[model samples]
Target: MGDRRALETQLAVVAGFENPQARLEQYPTPPDIAAHVVHFADLQGDVDGRTVVDLGTGTGMLALGAALRGPRRVVGVELDAAALDTARDNERRVGTTTPIHWIRGDATRSPLCVHSDGNSETTVLMNPPFGAQNGRRGADRGFLRTASELADVSYSIHNQGSRQFVESFAADEGGEVTHAFGATLTLDRQFDFHEQETRDLDTEVFRIRWT
Candidate 1:
């Protein structure tokens, strides 16, 4: 609602508030990155007055952040029931009047219902799993495909290693990378396998527009 710094501060309160279960590849998108993504989208004139969908919205950080900017509507799609419960709690705490619809479903199979607002564009924002874990390879692509199919624009965060695959996949789905930036995804030790107190992951943020 205010400046970028204020928004970041608001979103940052959600960090580490509720950690995710590891089987789901559930890591909350850090507040700073979430703020950056939302703010950048706002600056592009894509968020305000638009319908924003947050695919795999772990705890609704991105969805809530986007809602704060006064979108027409916001929907958060998350499969994990636990995460959804937490998200609902967070939404109530923030006390925002902006409508945020939380759906419990698998993002890969989720279908978007576009409510047209006189040419106001739809934007899909996501931080999908990188699929680095066993048996979950190419997970991010599904979100990308779904976003491309439904939204006019998509902003996503992925492992740096997936850069080439993402670009190529976007082109195949009738979209092109309009902008991209890199960041460090600071991951706190959530799983048993994580030995470090925190790990910094090389990540990329992409803004893709459909043709």
Candidate 2:
């Protein structure tokens, strides 16, 4: 293992975070950073009293941040049992009264209506796998399709190159990008996987609105 990888595992240990598992690579964004994203992006939840569903909400960082920012409800959908447990644990640890719910479910197949109130609009924030390998295409496609079905607006994180990767889906779903921005990521050692020690983690944050 690279020194960076070793260092990362150590950090995750110190922070009481789980080791990187399949499709759980992003871990949890630190609270400060998560708050920054919510504030800077101006992503507040339903004022009419509804919820924002966070797909792929590993460790519930995004969901918790939304709660802190005064969402009516913050719901996180995660498939990984370990990640789900960690999220639930964190919610308790924080002792938040914000009505945060962590559901053990697949993000790609979830019904959007199930996660939000009928009167309130829905927004989804997620960081899903890039599907850079050949075998993971099924997972990627299913996730996108499910996301399209579930939310009014979805903000998903992808490698900046994903702009091209998901282009074909626009035709399939009759969807268009409402907004997108490129952001650079600074990673922890756990983020160092495969061969590279330090990769320039550039991402496109897309707002895909359902018509």
Candidate 3:
């Protein structure tokens, strides 16, 4: 509607969707951070005419934010059914005609063949699992690999500790890291294991392009 700042405030008003017991780690990206990522993506590549995809769109913040940028289409790919329902609710709340589509499947293995709409450039935005839990290692790699396959450019979020690993993985997937920045992401306590009501973690946001 207005500037990116104004859109951020509007996004802050929307509800976040979450499921604590998911097999994959579930952390909704903070509204401010989501807005910031989308704003940066807009600057890097004009999101207005591109097809934007949010790979692990937990609550659709990134997808909706891209929608605010007037993208031609915004697709949110998520595995959790509950999360999808919440995302749909969020779409209604936003009250815009932005073409948003929801695809329910694993981010790592979702079939991408049918989405071959010709000529439109694609930009992916995802806040994937950090793989901190047992057996969840390398989860981010799957998201990166898929992004490389489906989009020309991607903005992925990961832990600061995983910077090297992420960079290496992207390079292997024929991606070049064009830009990155450090940020603190706020996580509200949503599980029994969490000791604090809210915690902030050091995180990195990366912008990569398919080489």
TM-score for each of the candidates = 0.95, 0.76, 0.93
**Clashing pairs in model 2?**
none
**Model 1, span 85-184: residue lDDT tens:** 8889888876678999999988998856774558577999999998878888888988998897778999999999677888899999888999999989
Which candidate tops TM-score?
Answer: 1
Alpha-carbon lDDT of model 1: 0.86
The Cα local distance difference test for each model comes to: 0.86, 0.62, 0.84
Which stretch of 10 consecutive residues in model 1 shows the poorest summed lDDT?
13-22
Q: In what order do the candidates fall by lDDT, top score first?
A: 1, 3, 2
lDDT of 2 by residue, 1-211 (tens): 1132322232232132576664445545544445444543344332124466888887876676555555567789887887788888877765557887788887877744654445666666676777765566545566677777766666677777777656667456867776677767655556445566544577777767665
Error of 1 at 25 (Å): 0.7
Q: What is the C-alpha RMSD of each candidate to the true structure, in Å?
A: 1.5, 7.1, 1.8
User: Candidate 3 regions off by >4 Å?
Assistant: 114-119
TM-score of 2: 0.76
Q: What is the lDDT for 54 in model 3?
A: 91
Which predicted model would earn the best lDDT? 1
